[model samples]
Target: MKDDVDTIALVVVLVLFAAVTVLGFKAARWSRGSSLASLDEWGLGGRRFGTWVTWFLLGGDLYTAYTFIAVPAVLFASGAQGFFAVPYTIIVYPLVFLFLPRLWSVSHRRGYVTPADFVRGRFGSRALALAIALTGILATMPYIALQLVGIQAVFEVMGLGGSSNILVADAPLFLAFAILAAYTYSSGLRAPALIAFVKDALIYLVIAVAIIYIPTKLGGWTGIFDAAEKKLTALDGAAGNPADFSFAGVGQAWPYATLALGSAMALFMYPHAITAVLSSKNRSVPRRNAAILPAYSFLLALLALLGFMAIAVGVNPVGLNGKPNAQLSIPLLFETMFPSWFAGVAFAAVAIGALVPAAIMSIAAANLWSRNVYKAFLRPGASHADEAKQSKVVSLLVKFGALLFVLGLDKSYAINLQLLGGIWILQTFPAIVFGLYTRWFHRWALFAGWAVGMIYGTWTAYNIPNPASGAQHFGGSTAAIPLLGEKGYVAFTAWVLNVVVTVVLTLVFRAFKVAEGHDETSPDDYHADAGEPGVRDVATPGAAGKAGAAAEA
Candidate 1:
């Protein structure tokens, strides 16, 4: 539980950071398209990435710094409930396998960069697309802020110094984020797409080594679980409490299960997630990646073991102002066990892992702003180059904003922003997801749903109280809604209420023959592929076939 990073570890960390910075600059050349002028290329990496690249890109973007630190941290603090991340990640792939291909096909054929692009095309309403885009960008900001939180955790572990010197604790963080902002601005999605390989490799190496070596240090798998159970059981505070405490509580399996499901539903709605999906060369790439990517789930299962190891090794959270720093469990475990050099690599991996997703998220958010807000309202006739330029500038600003979040904001508050993101973005499901299949709901009704859901979700989240933290409305997802009268339900519960209102209002509006927006897209658009004739806006079947055959022959 002390600052133990060695000089050798520091050198290795420096080397890896240098390698990633170089890779960021080099990414601009990896799959250079005919031009970087258009959103199709700049915003989406030319929309030509193969299945392999996309697998890594989407995997890297989705399984973020929080996924690396927070899941294990939760497990170390709680128990089996933290394992919900594993099942949720697993469950998400099947849903992606089924839905994302259709989304990909439609987006590809429509020249859509953001999901809002498709929403506008399908709904024939600028306001609807703007709403979806706004939701995406807003949801993604806090999520990006949490990525910085991951990097900060890594710095706290690696620097291993007192926070008395603000400059010492924060100087390295500023430098790292500055490098990330520059590269993402210069290279766009290419930076993160290329660096994901290193990020993932380091993560696998650290997790694999920890799984084999750390468990041996604690005896074995049996000993590790036993020690964890014993430690948690010693904390029993109630007559009916379970023998081993989980993160949430005893006898509340449904809340965790529902939380997992709700999280999966909202995951794809995040602008960053959708941006990665839209960048694929073909629809099948996303489907194939979904099927194969669960291999990370296997790794996540190993990462969760770090939590139990923390318990077995008796790595108690250090007292910072008399509060346990639950986030330090993994870092403490690694420092205590690994040699200097390997621990350094582990620290660098987490720090660099934060950058990869953070860059992509900023780009995604910036694209939403340029395309849905700037182009939609301000510059109706803006060129692709103009949109790309605007996005690059916004991406830089986003990183700076994340820097402020890390420097000034509480880490728990940042995490609550992420939960709020989930709740707010989930409100768009009725618009984005259902809009993909049908236009039965009136556009105004969808707008009403989004507005109501956003207000209710934010208000509810704002009012919840945490007795432990003395914070109002946003401690952690563990807090509940009084109206729901259910435990373990938080943001997800807010989403459910949002959906019910959406459905009921849609029915009422439909019965009255309200003026729903035009559906410019047809059902056939969802099935169109790159090789299909007239796939993009310029072609129909006859013209599309000629183009494909020309390219082939």
Candidate 2:
């Protein structure tokens, strides 16, 4: 359907966008630090966020605009399978509860700004740390692009994407991204941390209203489900296979279960998630937030039901190229179901949601590059201020790279790239997560395993075709295991191979007396907390020497 410009909704969205932009610029002064010259201040919000701020920041970080858009889109396109996100998110907090506090403690004690920083300090291998850092940047760039896709979906629904001229069509998207990139450069992580407050408020309010109002208008959940069932069951795939609307069939259960498990493991492995965890003021903040974050999972489950609601209302959204676009289902649903002003508010929630995670991801990616790649490889003695400057500049480039993904590539291709990113990132788990608890895996063996897993995952993902999208490769996340008869999430399968290779190689290399690099961290460092004795001096050599002198005095 061709949509005219939603002038009222556009005005409301612009107003909210302006308000958030103001907050983003002023956030440099929020909880004002001594200087914004250090990565500790710029990349991490000075590591002083308490329970409430951490809650919202982490929420804004993980439950991204993509989650607000794609989860429901998958449900709208393919029923029940899309709900794998719900279980994945539900299982994630418990997994996070197990390890994140330890990560936060070690990072805080040692002044590690990125996961690669912790990996380098733990294993003493720049090569291994470089792998983790590069994978993070690779995985995150497409994700940030997905955020732009989220914002674009809203814009397209508001009729900003129907222009005959390309520049005119994408002007709003470029402008929004430019503003986000500017504030993030000037204010750093604080910009996103501050904007997360308004983002979450708008999100919760929109979701609350959507669940209540849309169901009643559609005659409740029963009616919505029936309509969806009727519509989906009648629709056949290109191969003429009837769609599975109720739940995963016998063939799909493994993929569903494994996708959830793999995603749960990979969630915390992402740099942005760790950035949020590391920014917390205390160790207990993450533990408490882990318990509380599942509340958003409940909201996500409710949001997933909006797919059925859209089907019931017969909402069909067209993309910029005038093709069928499931990503616009929720945005179009609100446009049809709600008044103009309320729809504007819903669109703003998603657009602002994009901003928070995009800022966080770009910052995380920049920190990884600056700390691991730039500092370790390019300049060994770069100062803290130098690191911060590199990150700010790189953050802008990262956003532009993502902008290219949105402008140059197909939207579904971007989505598939993000799925591929999950596959690639999960390959880092053995190096980062397992290394956290034990250093038994030889550094060389871990690197080999990562290389093997990455190659296998990419090769496997490249062969799986999506008949619906008419793509011959990289179409899905699940594939048949080599020996096992059942299909499973390719990441989990690849990870299993990764562990097997690591274990076998570790035994052989250790028996041969292969040199494992020195471990720079102590056991006690893993349990260190904020306000601990000597914690303040760990990051500063001068402070440490002065404190030693004071002790002698």
Candidate 3:
């Protein structure tokens, strides 16, 4: 790791990072769950977080480091297309307000640990649960890798990376991971939960200062917008830059709308988002947080505008690889536009942003493994302590696996995979979200629809050559809609197809008298509150069904 900028900036980042490290270790005691030896305590903070804590935690969890990095970078490199994130965040809250409370109620009533666990209980299908678990793990790895990419961007801008020797250049990132892994293993979900307060506070401060300060330095908002649009108008595709992006044209109307809607639908389906929601103490926590979480969307909208401010001030960030890396634009902007001391704080915000989401994501993925893969299939009789232990170990393994994606693959590929990750996870929506209310969807049909969506989305995304760089596959997310012939997001198209196939097959199954898997939930369970008699601490794999059975009996 090298420090190319003023030492204060890098030092500031390290100091703040070290502070969070201490906070992470201390979080295990903050809420004081019954036993850290159970997934309920370790993975979900014993489902005891109140409204304020849950708000900050979900804010920190959803508004990730990647969100700060990529959204602005997209606005910097492309144009209006990056703004899709803003509307999607807006759309998600109402949707979350409507369904998440039901999910929370059922989860607490039956002691469900992961969404896959809920899928299993709701549908009584192990194969389907495994499908959901595998999809979540697959979708989350690239997302976790994206967080590393966010950190790498900060390091590059700080002059800490960009070495020819792989190990030497990435050593600092590895160290950060080491610290994050240690704390997450020790504190579980609480590490990020506790640290989120600082993360959000730093973020609000940085964003507030940036929107007010940066625009003034650049001749105000109008000038920033004009400069961004003018620069966007004058784009020649970079010769070898895979990071090059296309500005969407008039036809972008459909694609942009679909992208926003698809993203909104898909966001909550992510294991990390679900984990955050499930960690809340009651049904009202999610609904209330959903109403307030849009505050982050406002922050995000302001953050995206900074891309234009970067253009206005002429902040050009060259990556460690000696290319114009748009992702580093914001960090470089702060370093160039702000005083050295404040710039350090901005860098810390970016780094800490990566940490909160990364920690939550790792825990979520590990919970999926422990609950659905290990306890469900490998060792059906694994105890609560055993599940917790398996999760801690797998959380470490998940971090290492994400590291491999960063070290071994192209950073752009990781970004592409994250986009694909959305598409992949959205497929599960038919099974989980729809299953939340209705059991009419045949389990076999749900599984088949999920597979269809996964295969079709991956294939379509694979065929989309990069509009900017002309890469062969997985180039971007938008494609020509199948029937409308209008350009639209592949995920939405795949989701529509998934829904159609599921509906058709459901009817076919009904005609043929196919068996519907036994559902372990009742109508009353969907609205049960925290104080209800059946509401218990989270259940392990083999135990959730028993808990529900006993509650009913």
Candidate 4:
């Protein structure tokens, strides 16, 4: 059971890691903006990224190391249910295509830094905007933590995490994080955007090698699938468990379909996703990226097959702490099958994947804190430079907070909390996504719906027990809907309730003649493009200087 550290692989990973760190620090000057003192330059990369940069940045920001690790890990554990990710990601692009252009347009038109900024402009309700901002920051914290888990999985597989002393074992991880924090503080979003090109190149190279080489070594895809079927079917239909080794069992379709749909809906609702979209130079960037991003979905489908490949290879990886670690499946699979040097490449891919998204999520969360919480509540008269400085400080805090999640919580609990985050973030859909199209929902009603959905989603997610983990609550993301007689994703069910409540309350509020908040956005703003006068004007350096002066005046 003792795994030896491959010195060659370790050295290779270290070299690549060092190279990325250097690139991250230098990224502050990559785009060469006039200044990095404003949120536009530091947080959103000056909102002038071209199509290719947008593709790599959004891909690295969204696919994430957590996606690379967790998707295959789930497939290794649960069989076909894990393939839900493939469909979810496939459907997500089309869903975003329907609304993101509008969001990008309006955001660019008004110089909004976060989705909460859009919400405030759209509804003119500070309380509602605060709710959206808090939900974003809260949901994003666990997501950033999961990226660390992705990195830790690689460390454990490479024999860097087997130490008995906590300090000795985690020292490497903390060092990697410190490097990530330093570069992010120096370069902001540009760090990740630049590093993403290298990170993604390595990932594609690793995944391409894995799909072609591993299957041949395992007796081809047919042999691999047969071995997986043999192993998984033996465990099928255990008491109180859904059937394994099949597409899905009876009554399982609802959960599977709903999980896919709900996740697709929630995908772009995340602030980081919005941040990636808004950072683009024009509406066409997101529209074009949406069409091309599904190329990653094809890669993901290939990656999911690695879970079955793990079964065929008899790979059972234990965590550094000696607990069973499903997340380590792919990393250990590479170690077992590939040579020392190539295994290092695969491990580095996962580790760097973690760094890319962690930087973006922290930056997005920091933007939320600065624009909605600090500037609105604590410093309404703050200048642009003041906001940027505060965000940099908050970004460091956010990274360390994610580090706490990795060090303080159990890995299984951390994964469950991430799933819980999906549920919590999905509740914001009513206000953000629906608001993009209409102002019919009363602002107070949307807030009320958000509260109800948050309460319901959290309670349901907390109460579901994981029979395998032996935990009493917070075990999974799927639950039975009351009176529906079917199990479904908790987030989608809560969303249904959220909409219903919003509809009901909107009518009641209208009948009572309650005041609706002013809408700061004009109808034309939704369709405005980079060619529009307002967008062109805001893109000017002089306009930014004037705005800063006016704020100070």
Ranking 1 against 2 by TM-score, winner: 2
Candidate 1 lDDT, tens digit per residue, 375-488?
Answer: 999998999899999999988887777676556544533345466678778887887888887777778778777887788777776666654356655555644545765565
Steric clash pairs (candidate 4)? none
Q: List the residue pairs that clash in candidate 1.
A: 464-473, 533-544, 533-545, 534-539, 534-540, 534-544
Candidate 1 residue-wise lDDT at 396 = 84
- For 142-176, candidate 3 gives per-residue lDDT tens digits of 78888888888888888876678989889878988
**Model 1 lDDT at residue 42:** 67
Per-residue lDDT for 260 in model 4? 87
Q: Provide the TM-score for each candidate, comma-separated.
A: 0.92, 0.95, 0.93, 0.95
> Between which residue pairs do clashes occur in model 2?
none
Output the better candidate (3/4) by lDDT.
Answer: 4
In Å, residue 430's CA in model 2 sits off its true spot by 0.9
Per-residue lDDT of 51-115 in model 2, one digit per residue for the tens?
88888898899888657888888777777788998999999988889899899888888889999
RMSD of each: 4.2, 4.5, 5.2, 4.1
Ranking by TM-score: 4, 2, 3, 1
Model 2 scores worst on lDDT over the 10 consecutive residues at: 544-553
| Candidate 3 minimal-lDDT segment of 10 residues | 236-245
